[model samples]
Target: MAGNGSFWVQIMPAILFLQLLFRAVGTDGASSFSFANDCQYPVWVGVLSGATSPPLARSGFYLPPSGTFQLAAPSSGSWSGTFWARTGCAVDSSTGRFSCATADCGSGDVACNGRGPSPPVTLAEITLASPGSGGQDFYDVSLVDGFNVPVRLSPSGGSAGECRAVACAGDVNAACPSDLRVVVAGSGGVVACRSACDAYRSARYCCTGEYGSPAACGPTNYSQVFKTACPAAYSYAYDDASSTFTCVGASNYDVTFCPRT
Candidate 1:
């Protein structure tokens, strides 16, 4: 009996090592997103899953200044989604409903419950690769909806070159054009910047009708302003050539709100 006990103890270590090795080799290719709030004020983060993708555990949550939260992607298959931050959020005393000065999801609560954010919001978009597909991950920071906060999306443990960090760390609201600026009452501050499409709603700016194609719709003066402020971000709907980034295999990503320049 004593001899048999020693034999089992010796074999246990070998079994454990094999299990760990198998886990490393058979990774599910799922990724994790780390959300960080670097701003001086608190921000409410909102997430909206793509139509074909599964929703995350919490669609929205409050993140205090310098706070961090991590969420893992679904391991079953590919996932795609967009994340953004809502600023100046507070419960309305009269109505007892939650709202934000910018990028409100209109859920009347802290959780967005799968609702997409309003315009004049900065967006971080990602489409993760499927397991064993050998496909690349696509990510970008888009200002096509507008700019409410500066965001940075950086890949970790991924391939080089195109997997580099992309950010819209510029203060676009301060330099926003008069017609495109969103000013909050009482405070009287330019809290967000509206896109030309959102502000004008014209065929040329909205890229509809005859200007639907990329060839027909080129960068306009309004988009150039956003491009000059944050060159790595998608300034307009067709700003794909320089905005989109790809990574071969990133274990995790850091999405920082109000990221430093």
Candidate 2:
């Protein structure tokens, strides 16, 4: 048998090669997000880096049916951002511009630049672990603004047993009340649903001013409807008690569009 020093020397090159590969992939024992579209139609996926943080990949990209896009985390050590799906997209033949009927970012093209999402969108949010915590990431599905599609956030090959997976996998559009429904243009069908705050725009529904505090902003009947439909998502602004999930030492995550069957 070779001595311990000799054995390590023989394997050092292989170990160094793996380290380089991991860094190139952007999951070098750190955290990253991978997006996939399972819908039968193309989907424009928008990525927004957290405020005060730098962006990783392109702001937006067109994902063909069953296509995938993987992005390594930003080099900023700790980062946070939101991801959403835009459907019913098409290029304006006359103007040669890209647009989507749902989750439109109002940039008049596939790329959203730095625009925030329009209402009636399902959002997946991730905040990587801080350096002090030895690396634990927080993730969630949020319907606080509303729901236009189903989304699932799953952690893969990581130290995330309790973290598990979270999804708002229901078609809230079909269940949306007439007063809160957003009908698509061509189909005239409910392709998206709005929150009570968005639909009503009242202080009560929006939890503003006197209702802004967590103690003041208890769940209302309108918010209960969304919570019942999506127990794992943030139904309203103050619905943070059970809506957040944490993963320790995770390698990467996969965010899926149209995750529900």
- Best prediction by lDDT: 1
Provide the clash count, candidate 2: 0
Tell me model 2's lDDT, rounded to 2 decimals: 0.83
lDDT for model 1 comes to 0.91
The per-residue C-alpha lDDT of model 1 at residue 214 equals 96
TM-score, candidate 2, is 0.85
- Per-candidate TM-score against the hidden true structure: 0.89, 0.85
State the lDDT of candidate 1 residue by residue for 58-104, as single tens digits: 89999999999999888767889999999999999999999999999
* Alpha carbon lDDT of each predicted model: 0.91, 0.83
Collision count for each candidate, in order: 0, 0
**Ten residues in a row with the worst lDDT in model 1?**
22-31
Kindly report which residue pairs in candidate 2 clash with one another. none
TM-score of 1: 0.89
